[model samples]
Structure formats: structure tokens, C-alpha cells
Target: MNNKLKLSNEHTLARVLEIKHYTKALFSFKTTRPNNFKFKPGEFVMIGLIIKGEFIFRAYSICSSTWDNVLEFYSIKVPNGPFTSFLQKITTDSSIIIKTKSTGTLVLNALTLGKRLFLLCTGTGIAPFISIISEPGTYIKYNEVILVLTCRYSQELQYFNYKVKQMLKQPYIKLYARNKLRLYLSTTKGSYPYSGRITWLIKSGMLIADLKAYNFNRMDKFMICGSQQMILDVVNLLRSIGYLEGAINNPQDFVYERAFVS
Candidate 1:
């Protein structure tokens, strides 16, 4: 093993605390965070492992809340993927590499004050929103927080449903957000409580009706994370209704980040 190809040990060794396989293709894992590791709830950081003296890494959203003791991540195991292939084989106490810096456009700071915050996501894109909804800022900033998740199968929704139910049981979360938080789990290829693309549901006005939300007022803000296609389609949908893109420096109506680069 060449020392030149090895990762540095200064601020980035994350020991795996636990791993949960949600499905054949999806999983979630928690790791020991460095005492100095700091990040907003909805940001992403480079997570990796040293393989045969080579450092291989990818950007992963932190699925755990900032207040949580350990860092958590939700991921998709691409069968032959260079990174995930090795990642999925890890067991308890395995050491993983994490880059010190974390950043993303999905944080609540990227959007201005609003009465309602809509988190639109698909598949693993739901990772960041999980952190967002778990944070105290989400409940304080908006009267309501809506999580809209669309996947191809109903079973894929299990992880989120379980987490939400667990969060609901937390005394503080339930007290502040029991009625304010909402989850809309939908599937496109499987029979579920809600079926069809979120774009269509938004266009058909069924989403608002289901929530019985006040008319899409100017105070509504949106944060979108998903495939490029899903993000683009939803952008068009929001724009058609007078929404605008936002950023940290110039917070506007909505913000978005690509779920995966490929």
C-alpha cells in the first residue's frame, strides 16, 4: 500500500455504528461522528472508504439530525458501483472515511420565511428532508412541513414511514409538530394509498386538496431533491404557478439540489 494514495487521518475517520438494509437496493447506516464534525441538518458530505490504499468517495446526504449523537446516511447500493459495491459489504464497527466539510443547497437557510415548506423528493432523495424535518428549525420556521415522496414501489416507502412514526412518538417532536408535519407517500408502479407522479398530482390540484391547505399563497416555500428529471418537471410545475428559484444569498420561493449527478 502506497502512503501517497492513502487518506489522511486528521479529521475524518467514521466508525460504523450500525447498518440497516431497507431493501435489496437501499440501506441506511450510522457512524461515529468526530467531536469537531459540524453540519446543518440538510447538508451533504463526502463519505468514503480507503480500498487497497486508494480513496474512493461519493457525496451522501446526512440522514440524521444535527443533534443526533451519530451521523447517519441513506444510500442506494448500485450492484457493481465502484463505491457502493464495497460500501454494502461493511459490518458493525467498520471504519469509514468522511470528509470534514459538509455543504448543500437543501438547508433551511436557503429559503426565506414561509408559512408552509414543501419537501419534494423521490427514492433516496428523501435523505436530506429526513434531516430537515427532524430539526427544530423546521417546526419553528413554518406552520406546516409537507414531505412528498414518490417511489416505484410501496415497500420502498417503508423506511420513511417507520422513521416518521418514530419521530411522532418523540415527546418534543409530537408536541411541536404532530399536526404540522405531513407525509405524502406515493408510488408510480405499485398500488398504494397515493399513486401517480407528483407532477400530475400537483397539476391536478389533488395535493393541496388532500392537505386541505390554504390556497397556494405567497408564503408557501418549496425544497426539492430528486432525479434530474423529477426536479426539472417539478420546477416547471412550480413556475407555472408563479414560484421562483431561491438561494442562500437571495432567498426566494424554492430551492433544489440534484439527488444524483449521473
Candidate 2:
């Protein structure tokens, strides 16, 4: 199946906006979007850069909230590789090409509504969480939001921690009595404020306590993103606990996507 389609200029553009450095190799950007363009959060887009008359493209998830006019993405610099090598040097307001028609299954619409929302991710996988966490509607739609992020070390968790701290200062958002958003983090290779992989935490029921969650049930929704292994791990674990998969056509207790192939 030729699922790939060449987009028209209407859906593609070279706009420059903001650039940010998260770690030594990971960075993010915000680009201007066409006035008429709109998309759900967590959808991946074909982003590319023009170099030497060639367009080098890669799949990147949109990390910005849908209400925002501009699109956002979190990226990793591929050493001496196609787009990232040059992308890392891009300053704020630098131009880069983007394709139209973003698509992916990670959007919140794909999952079944539940009493609690579990977002499990690792590394850049936290990209989509940025969008989900920022939306006040996300909190309104679910009773509670619990995010579990894993990285090689605590430093990688800094980007997410900073954003949540900012959200905490929002008076209106914090006003939602039971609509609290919690962050659970683990660092596999290095010591962190929190200890292990999400799978381990869930299996041992440690994450449930850490989030102060009651219990896993069909009344809960789970969004899993990370390495294939992590997704499978969480999926099977959830299934054992009675959670199921979901889609727009047939919403289930859970939905999934790769954060960025780990």
C-alpha cells in the first residue's frame, strides 16, 4: 500500500519561528503554520529540510496544543546525519520545510474515556505529553491525569518537569479539584528522584501508589508511547489488568504510538 502521498504546497511550507535546546543532542522548534491549518495533538508530520537542492524528511510528532496557531516538535540531533546535523544549528526564526496532512494514532481522541488517564513514555516520547498536558480540556475530559516518563537519566526529565511546574502556577487549571496531573519518572541507567522503568513500576504496583491512583480498571485509559518493547510491555501488562486497545472506530481502554522509535 502506498500510504505515503506527496503533499501540495498548500500543506507544506518553510517557516521559521522558535528553537530550544533541551539537552546536548535533543532540541525542539515551533514553526509558523498556515492560517487555515488545524490538527489534533500527538499527530506525526513529515518534516524536512532543504539542503543542496534535496529535501531530507523525517517523522516528528506535533507537541503543541491544537489551539495554538503554530506547530511544535521535539527532535534529536542525528550526528552527521541528514536533517538533524544542520537542524541543530538553526536559530530562532530560521526556515525549515514542513509537509501538510499530519497523521498518527497517538491523539487523545483515539482512546476510551476513563476515570483516569495514564500517559506512559520515555525519552523524546514525552514530546506528545507536552501537548496533552497543556490542554485544560484534557483535564476536563478525564478525572485525573498521571504521566510516567522514563529516560536514561534525571537530566532528560528536566524539560518535562519545568513545563509541569509552569502549569502548576496556572490558577484556573489548578482550580479543578479532582483533575490533578501527576508526574512519575524513572531513570534506568542513572539514579533519579524516582527509581525504575515504567513497566517495572506498573508490574510491581509501585506506580499506582506513586500516582496515588486507586486501581487499574476498564474505567481507566492508558496511552503508551516509547520503544516497541515498552509499548508491548505496558499493553500486555494492562491487558492482564483488564485494559484493552482503542481506536476512533472502536474505542478501547487504551491507545498507542511510538514516541519517536525510542
Candidate 3:
């Protein structure tokens, strides 16, 4: 009998290191990164498990920094989801398939020069921003880094709240991230202190007023990720205000990635 793990040329096996369940429907996991795996901070890669000799994969944005030894991902558990149903059952003893290639429009190279960098996201959309802010270069590139995260419930905001605190305490980027990095959280449901969708906040000028910053201008760069509807709304709003969508080959004022909404 042969008990060797077999993967395609584009995939590799990675060992699960840790898993944390934030809520019944939301969880995060860490895995040992392959030495050869290379990716930008805001990129995502396909990950999955081999079930019954069939590979089932899903695109998950990486939540860890490029310099980190391990790779982390934030995920939402869809009831009976083809890949997530089995992923939620994984343990530290299990191994998952990781595709080596990573790609996304949220990378730093996609944006032109800007003074303030705004990372707008909702729910698990916060995943890529985690990696983006964790990179030391992010602070150096912009004078201010603002992260606006919105969720349906306050409980969904806990993970990022904790992560932001930790980033402020990390020695390597502590000084750079101290006052430069700011976090704004909101909940669409419940009576949370800040309650509203990000689109509403921006449209009403409350987002800038709350931050006590200047109004949206060409000097500001935006990276937006979230549900399809949220992305569309934000993109439309930005476009109306003269913000151009950026790409790898064409750097512009803003970039957006449609996160895995399921």
C-alpha cells in the first residue's frame, strides 16, 4: 500500500498548524507555508482538501504578512458548502492542498502615489487588509492607513479588533504603525456604537468627518473588498467622485477585489 500525498504540479501539501473559530459560521486557520510559496500581501490563492480522490478548492485571501513563516486565512463556513463544509472539520493533524500561484487586484502596485490609504471591507473581506496592513511597507507608502470594517454583528468585529491591537504592539512595525494605523468598525445589525454600512458612511460624509480627515480627493487611495453588492456600491460611489479603478499594469487612485461572499 502506498501512503504518499500526491498533488498536481501547481499545488503543494501544507500541514495545518492552528484553527480558531470566531463564530459558528466564521473561523480562521493557519498552516505551515511552503518555502517556495511566494505571494504579495493582498493576494489570494486556491486552497482545498482532496475528498474521495477529488480536489475541491476555493479562493481564500491570505491574512498573514509576507514575512510570516506561516500562512493564515479567514473563512466563512457556509452550511454544507462544497469546500467549507469539509474545511471546518479540519484539525491540526490534517493536511490541505495549497496552490502556489497567488493573484489579486489589491496589491500595493495597483495604486498610484497617495497620501492616505483607506482599506474598506465588510465581514470576511477584512482578510486581505490584514495582510496589507501587516506589511511594514504599507506604512512607509502612505502617511495614514485607515481600515474601515463593517459586519452584520458586533461579534464579527472582534478578530480584527484584536489583530489591530497586536499590530500596534509588535516591535518591528510598532513605531511605524502607532499613530499611522487606525481602525474603524461598524455593524449593520444590532445597536452597536457605530452602526451602518460603509457605503452609507462615505456617501453621507460621515466617514471623513469621523476620521477628522480631509474630504475624498486625488491624494487618497482606496482598496475595497467585500460582498458583490458592497463592492459595486462602493465602486460606483468612488467613480462618481472621480476615482479611477486601478490594475497591475495601470496604477490608479483605487483598486477593489470582490471577496468570497459565501
State each model's CA lDDT, in order: 0.85, 0.77, 0.89
Error of 3 at 134 (Å): 0.6
**Better structure of 1 and 3 per lDDT:** 3
Score every model by TM-score.
Answer: 0.94, 0.87, 0.95
Give the distance in Å from residue 222's predicted Cα in candidate 3 to where it truly belongs.
Answer: 0.4
CA lDDT, candidate 2, residue 233: 84
Q: What are the clash counts of all predictions, listed in order?
A: 0, 1, 0
The residue-by-residue lDDT of candidate 3 on 74-161, one tens digit each, is 9899998888899999999998889988987789999999999999999999999999999899999999999999999999987888
**Which candidate model has the greater TM-score, 1 or 2?**
1
**Which candidate's lDDT is highest?**
3
- Please state the error at residue 226 of candidate 1 in Å: 1.5
Q: Residue 226 of model 2: what lDDT?
A: 76
